[model samples]
Every structure is written in C-alpha cells, then in structure tokens.
Target: MTLVEGAGPRTGAPPEPLRRNREFLLLWSGASMSFLATRVTAVAYPLIVLWHTGSPLAMSVVSTAALLPLLLVQLPAGALVDRWDRRRLMLGCEAGRVLAVGSVALALAAGRVDVAHLAAVAFLESALAVFYRLAERGAVRNLVHPAHLPAALAQNEARGRAAGLLGQPGGVLLHSAARWLPFGFGVLGYLVSLVTLLFVRKDFQAERTAPARPGRLTGEVAEGMRWLWRQRFLRAALGYVAGTNVLFQMLALALILRIKEAGLPSATLAVVVGIGGVGGLGGALAGGRLQRLMSQRTLLIGGAVAWTLLIGAMALTARPVLLGALYAGTGFVGAVFNVAAAVYQVRITPDAFQGRVAATAGLIGSGTNALGSFAGGLLLTAWGALPTVRAIAAAMAVLALLAAVAPGLRGETAATPRTAEPVDPVEPTEKPVEPTEKPVEPTEKGEGDR
Candidate 1:
C-alpha cells in the first residue's frame, strides 16, 4: 500500500506525532515486552540446562533448538503471516510463548527439569518469535505515516539493543536468586504484551481486494524469494550483510576467548559486551537523523569501512577496556547500517510482499550465524584468539572493498518504489493515518479516517 499522510480537516494543522499515536504506541510497547522477555529466556535456557543436568551437551542442544527456528521456520512463517490475520497471528504467538515458557517455570518449581522438555520449549518459543517478528515488521509501515517510518524503525532498533543490554544480565541475576524467576518474568512480560495487543484497533496489513488464493507452501515461499532476488540492490546488499553477520558472530566469540586468554574475570567479558550494547543503543537513537542526512549507499559502504577498522583495532588490543571500545565502535556502525537497510527495504517492498520479502532477507543474512560460531571455535582452537581475530579482521577488509565496488549498491537510492500500489484516501483522525500515494510526501491530515 502507498505511504500517505493523515488527512486532517482544513485546519492546516500538522499531523499527530508518533508519541501521541495511540495504536502505534500499543504495538510498539507490546512488541518491546515480547522481545525483552525472549531475550531474558535466551540466557536462562543454557543456564538452567547446565545447572540441572550438568551437561554441556544438553545446554548446547537447548541452545541449538532455540536457533534452529531461524533456519527451519522463517520461510514458512513468513508465508503464513502473509496469508493470516497479522494481529491474530501475533496474539496467538504471544499466547503460545506464554504457555511454553510458563510450563518450564512450573516444571522447575516442581523440582523437575528435563532436557527434552526444555528443548521443546526453546524451539516452540523461538518459532513463535519468528512469526511474531515477521508480522510486526509488516505491520509497522501500515500503522505509522511514511514520514515517520524511519523514526519508528529507529526506535525499534533501540528497543532491541536495550533488551540485549539488560536481558542477559537480568536473566543471570534472576536465575541466581531463583531457578524459576527468569521464566516467571517471561510469563509476566508475555501477559502484558498480550493485554496490550488486545487493545490495538488498527488493521495490521493493508486492505486486500480479495483473499489471497491458497497455494502450495513451498510455492509461496519461492514466490517471495524470487521477488526479493529481482531487487538488484537488495540482493547485493543482503550478500554484504550476510558476510558481515558471519564475521560479527566470529568476532563475538573471539572477544570472549580474548578475555579468557588474558586471564580476566568473567565480569570483564560482561562489561565489554554491555558497553557494545550501549554503543548500539546510541547508534539506533541517532539512526533516523542519519538516514535523513545520508543515502543508503553511503550508509552501507561507510558502515562496512567502519567495521573493518574496528575489527582491526580489536585485534591489536588484549586489554579489556580497549577491546570494549573497539567492539563498541563496530556495534555502533552495525546498528546504523541495520536501521538504514531496514527502512529502505520496508519502503520498497509492497505490503502484500512484506512478510515474505523480510523473511527471505533474514534467512539469507543470518542463516550462517551458527556456522560462524562453530568456525570461530575451530579457529580459536587451532590459531588462538589473536590470530583468529586478525584473520577475521582481514576478511572484513575484503567485504568492505566489495561494498565499495558493488554495482547494485552504487546504484541504490532512497526513493520509494515506483511500482507500489496506491492507498485509498480516508478522512483524517487525531490518530496516525493509513499510508497513501507518494510514500515520501507529507499530505493533509484526516487521510485515514475510514
């Protein structure tokens, strides 16, 4: 659907800002609660498995279960999201997550913790999260005016970083106090998210003339993949993003190894990573302004260069503080790059294709994360932390060079897609309007009053 301004009455007043947009706030806050709860449980899973079973293998299994959905569920989930009612899908996901996580809490309270049960919960929770996230991504552009899309997504990025900053530590602290505390908090968070979602009144997807015809699931997934593959710039940019994602995964492991090799306390590792989270949060907060100032090409290439430099700097320092500083720089660049790319993708993709396209891109970009972590382990085992980090840095340099010369990237722009369907005008309301034609241009208020 087209991104249009809210049509207000002939008062010539400015449109309602995001803070006052009741529907957007409900969606955002509800999503934030769900995401934070997921993060907290992410940390607790391994901790609970290892503490009870005393089996690193069991912990690995649980962790792998959590990650497996990224590979197996994303494509199908995307297709399903496009076919189903997005708000209903999200509500179901939240409900599923609550029951899954709550079961774990209840089991723990009963002094029963089984590896198989934990793995099932982790897998189910992660899979549900995939559906929720895909639906949310498609819903955001529909809820806010086009002019505020970048800002809204920036806020989303910041929320994710902040969750990362607090979730792990919060999980650890909560688990220390009680085995079931983390999951209990997760239950509460999901309940709150569920309640908020119930209050959201806007439609999650653009209005369709008719229901989409049912098709083979694989065919639907392929349709999305083909559509994304046709976008030349997005195709090439996703390649760059995938490469960096792999390297960043390696870098994360390298940092932990470096701290251990330096005989530093575990607390040092936490501090270093936490500092990186702060950097990401800062970058996310600034992303909207950065998008306004820089073109997509500039942001992507510049971010690659910045990451390369930071990785190189990280290789030279064994000091905890120095490593933290360098890692933070990479986080900052990565966050800015993510915000720019997400805004561009959301703007260019059609409302109908949003879920599939986003899922396709996510699958390509993050599918190798596990491989990177595994490779990092092997590299650290064979070459040690410093050598492995130096190698990663050199590889990042190659990606940076590729970004500079990539033809698709060179031709990228910030303009709206020419082929997007026009949105029908509606009367304006005090709340944000539905999107309309000319996705970037601001129009009169009262455009969304159905």
Candidate 2:
C-alpha cells in the first residue's frame, strides 16, 4: 500500500462502496444524463447541418465550431473553478448549457432553425460543457472515500461509454422522427441533471487558501505545467497518451473506410461500433484488478501496444468481421488505459493543484487529438485513407515503444505523501484499531485518466 503522511480516516479505510453513498448516486445519475446529452448533440449537429445545406463545407464548419472551446477555454475555466465553490460552478455550467441547447430546440421545433443557428448553439453549449466537466473532475475526490476512488472512477468512465452507445444512435433515430427531436432530448437531459444536482447534498471542501496577494491565473497554470514537465514520467506519459489518441482517431477513420470499401452495409458498421460499448464495460469492470497487479506505467504501455497491434491487423485485412474484432479490442484497451491514467493522477496530484493540473493536461491532450485529426484530414485528401491509416498504425508502434523504454520515466507510481506534499488528500487517518486488518484495500488503487 502507498504510505501517505498524516493520513485521515476518510483516506485510510477502504472507501465505502460508492453505490452506498446517496450523494454520489445522485451525482452519478446526473453525470450519466449529461453525458448522454452530449453524445446526442454530437450526432445531431452534423446530421442536421448535412440535411440542411447538402454542403460538406457546412458540416465541417459545425464540427470546427464545436471543438474550439476545449482548445480555448480549458485552462482559464479550470483556474476559475479553483477560485470558486466547485458545485456551484458545475450547476451554473449545466444551467447555461441547458438554456443554450434549449434555445435551439425551440427554434427548430418552430420551423425557424438554420445551419448557422445550430452551429452557434453547439459552440456555446460545448463551451459550457467543457467548464462543467472540469469542475466535475475537480470535485470527484470529495464525493468518494479515498480507497473507493478506483471503483468510482471506473463507474464514471463506464457511464461515459454507455452514454456514447445508448445516446448517439438513439439520437439519430429520433432525428429521423424530426431533426429537432435530438436537441429537445439533449435539453431535457440537461434539465434533469440540473434537478439532480439540486437535490444532492455534498461539499467539495478544499483546505488550500489562496495567496493574500493574488497570483496571475496564467502564472498558476504555468506552475502546473512546470511541475508536470519537470517530472520525467509525467512528460512521457502525457506524450504517449496524446500520441495514442491521435492514432486511435486515425484507426477510427480507417475502419470506417475499410468497412465501406468491403461493401459492408450501414447496419453492419453500426453493430460493430455498438459492440465496442461491451468492451468498454468489461474494461471498466477490470480496472480495479488491473491497478493492483500492474504498474501504472506498464498498464499504459501494454494498452498502447495492444491498440497498435489491433489497428495494424485491421489495416491488413479490411474484412468486416476482422474490423469488428479489432475495434472491440481497441475499445477495450482504450478504456483500460483511460481508467488507469485518471486514477493515477488522482493519487499523485495535490488537492491544491487538482483543477489547474487536470485542466492543463486535459486541454493540451485534447488539442493534440484535434491537431492530429486535422493533419489526418489533410493526409486523406492528399493520399487517401488506407496509406494514412497504415502510417498512423506505424506511428503508434513507435509511441508504444516510447512508453515502455523511455528513460527517466520509469519511476511513475501511485503518489506517496513524501512526493506530493502540502496538499493532503482525505482527512488524517486515526491510529490503527487492530493489527490484523490492513485498513487500506490492496485491490483498489491507482485510477488515472488520459
């Protein structure tokens, strides 16, 4: 077990089973609903634009608009969250998204919608969602006991994958009924999430006090970056994650093209994508066991290797069944990697640095993926999908190697109080009641995210 200095009772005993906590249950329920809404919005924006303009350029613009917020707002939003009460920040964000998306739903239902209007709403809604997610991530540690952190994070990730599966296709189906239906569904989900938050009673209490003299927000963010970068392990891990994400997007692009190239029907493609949700579910369930048995660094390397092999195999075989098999494996690896990374970060980060550190890493990571896709799009236009996919697969193999053999990065492990000082997690642990019990659960630890 990782030894923490001044361990608090809240951090010592195996965290109470997450599901047993009423406040956590309410929060989880709300998160699930909001995640589902995001998925629906993802599908609705593109489909609605395509239907209206029949202009591929118009569709592309909507995608660009939706993604801009993450690249621009994450660090500032994270800093702001740190300066305010996390729950209120989350609630306000949810309320804002609800109104932004609700306006679109009303406009569409009233026969007054247009592509420009839909894209503008999408931008505002996505921006609100970015801040909301940052606050939620920052507040998570306050909800569950320290020992239960892995399971709680795993469950959250599972809901995210579940939302993607249950919501996106469902959105498309509803859109068939009426283009406006999906937006209405998203608005309703946000409102439900807001109501759930209203009923939940939990506090995200931080012990850190801001400086008497205010520090520059940019300077604080830079401090987070400097600390992360100085730690060789963190730098390599971040690089590997960002590279893996780009490769994963490329693989996704390749699989779609390969399926179509093989003359598979749309239903077959849908089924393949839907089946990935099962793999995500399995990965989430397996995270607890994996953390105990595998080093965080090893988990990341192995997951990256697994994904690379699966994508490479798909590139070689273009058969629909082969593609599905590879996709399921890729999804499984991706989920496990995300779970391990997130928990690991929670274990390492000082509570004071949580919001800024998490957001800086998140924003940069997201930007890398976006940049990768943009590059891939250019590659596709110049050389087409197959070559670009093969190159992407090869690049992943190199990144996986970097994660495994990178020097100065081998010591990455769960945080020990010796390393992450000043900001303590959980209240201090009481003196041991009995020697026979370990107090801390060995099977559950290290939940990090990508």
Candidate 3:
C-alpha cells in the first residue's frame, strides 16, 4: 500500500492487487470519476431537454446523436489507437471532453443553448469517449497480472453500477433544486477525473506489440472483425447480449411508466430500483466465480430467459408491489448478465486486438440500443404503453429462444479448451508486476493543453 500523492490513504488491504499496480489504480480512479459524471449527464440530458422542449422525442434525439458517433468513428479510431500512445490518447480525450461538455454547460447557463448545440456537444463528447474508453480498456492487461484481471474487472463493474446508483439520484436531487445544478456537478466530476489521472506513473503503461507491417487499414480492421467472428463462444455471448439490449430495453424503461399508470408512488419506484442495486452489487461481485462454474454462453442464455420471464410476469401482474419486486429481481439478473458478457469478451480478446474488437462490438451494441429506444418510443406512442410493453416482451421471448438454441451458440463451450483460457480470466493470489522494472517511477504533472 504505497502512498499515491493526494490520493488519500489506501482503502484497500495490504496486499497489492496488481503487483505494484499503481497505474491501474490511477486509471481506475480516472475512469470511475468520468463514469460517475456521465451518470449525472445521463440524468440531466433527458430532464433538461424535457424542461426546455417539452418533448420525449427530443430527448431521444439527444441519445441518438450521442450514439451515432460510435458507428462512424469506432473502426477508424480503433485503427488509430493501435498506432498512438494510448496514454496520451486518453489524456487528449479527457481534456477534450471536459471542454466540450463544459462549454455546453456554459452556454446553457447563459441561456443560449439549443437543440443543435446540444446535439453537437453530445456527438463530440461521445466521439472522444469512444476512443478514450477503448484505449483505457485496451490498456488493462499491460497494467496488471493475469490473476488480478478478473477481480479488477469486477471492481470496475462495481464502480460503474455504484456510480449509476449514486449519480442518478444525486443528479435528480440537484436538478430539482436547480436545472443547471446537474451540469455544474457533471463538469466538476469530469474535472476531478481528469486531475486524478495525473498521479499515475507513465512507466507502468500498457504496452502494444508493433503492428503488422504493410497491412491496409481496411484489411487490418477486417482481420480483427474476422478473428472475433470466428470465435463461436464470443460471438454467441455477444448475440445474447446484443439481443438483450435490442429487445428488452423498452420493457425495462416501461417499468417506471407502468408503476405510474398503476398509481404506485415514485418513491416506491426508487425503493425498487435501490433493491435492484443491492442485487446488482451481489451479481457483479459473483460474476467471475459464476463464469468459472458455468460458461458465458450458458449464463447469458439463462440470464436472458430469466429476465424475459420476469419482465413478462411484471407485464401481466396487476399489483404494483409485485411488479416492483419483479424489477428488483430482473435488475439483479441483468447486472450479472452484463458482467458475464464483458468478462468473456475481455478474456477471449487478445490484448493487441482489444481496441479494434471492442470498438466493433461497442458500435453494434450502441447502435442497437439507439434503435431499440427509438422503436420503443414509436411503438409506445402508437400502440399505447401496455401493449408496447407486451410487444417488447414478445420480442425478448423470441430473441431468447432463437438466440440460445441457435446452432452457432449451442455448443460454444465444446470449442473452448480448459487450459487455453486466457490468463485474464483467472484471479491471482499475489499482486503481479511487469518484468521491465524493479519499482514504478514517479508521477508527472499533466499537460494543461491538448
């Protein structure tokens, strides 16, 4: 537990989790801060739009604009990441996002913000966010031992979910006090996130092997997609995850509206969501062990079925209390499902391939999410909320059955060798260190400019 300047006392136990994994800790802190702020943005984005425009579709456009950047930027950005210094890339991205979002906040405060400005800001921040996240995730293996990887990822998930729990509620509370409060809070969090990144020693950076010579950009991108495409287990897991996002999202969102329709108190809805958080914490913590016991394919397929059934049950139930109980149960399963997919994806993917492969997955995944949200809104508008929910449940059902039993997915475990599991999947008893140095060098001051 070596002291990291201004980082406060090490809250962790005496054993170093990633060997002298000080950089990983710093990176975690950086990512966690940014993610926490994003949660506030997540809340403020919709509420602010609603207050100004009085349209849910306007809010949906904001989400769509943010996501559209991924499809256009990810593959090219991934290729660029393979060529660039991942650390500098992340630094530039963080600094860029801070200004981008901060400028938007400033404009909003000045009463000059509009839909176009909001959309542009969302697009810019999301573009940087895509590359920054890819680099940061791509850097993980260089920072830690294979054994600590699983625990590290679990802790990351915990941070994200924890942020979601705290940030959303806090953002709402602040916005209730004042519309601009959340944006200000969001800016502060992003700044703190950027600042905390400075303490990490650069010598412990994630390393990349030299890229293949003479390969065309398009060819290299294809190679990565092909590698992942050939992996039955990974693709199958991706299928379930992709389907879950595409199919069940509307149902998930509709839960709140349903409670309102049934005359349930919004406070009771908060209690239900809080209960889901508890379940999520447990699931995230247990993710690795579960993966070890059951393959990702099994877990994903099972999780999908469980969530669909619970959602359908909620849709059928007349009582708000039972529906609320169902929400808690489904959230627990959903969290674990996410952990399973992410762990497997991270594990099977080679370190050199992380940036591109992850970007491809993220692009498709995010696009599907945007599409689902749009479709959900339109369907709910046309068919009414309850029937739209039933339609989503039907989609989830079809997705579950079609995806789980598909020929490509059914036997993925057969191809996976026990001894061949990537070192990233297993937890180590000791902190693992890189072979290049004895101890890490000192931290450097962050450059103020991009």
Candidate whose lDDT is highest: 1
How do all models score by TM-score? 0.90, 0.87, 0.78
- Which residues of candidate 2, in runs, are more than 4 Å off? 1-15, 211-215, 378-389, 417-450
Question: lDDT tens string, model 1, 140-179?
Answer: 8877766567778888999999988889889999999999
How many Å off is the CA of 389 in candidate 2? 4.2
Per-residue error at 244 for model 3, in Å? 1.8
What's the lDDT for candidate 2? 0.72
Task: Note each model's CA RMSD in angstroms.
Answer: 5.6, 5.1, 9.2
**What lDDT score is found at residue 75 in candidate 1?**
96
Residue-wise C-alpha lDDT for candidate 2, range 161-198, written one tens digit per residue: 88888888899999999978998889889988999889
Q: Write the per-residue lDDT of candidate 3 for residues 230-335, one digit (tens) a residue.
A: 7765676676667678765676567667777778777867776777776787777666455445665566667767876787777687464566577767777776
Poorest 10 consecutive residues by lDDT, candidate 1? 424-433
Worst 10 residues of 2 by lDDT: 427-436
Candidate 1 vs 2: which has more TM-score: 1
lDDT of 3 at 341: 63
Better of 2 and 3 by TM-score: 2
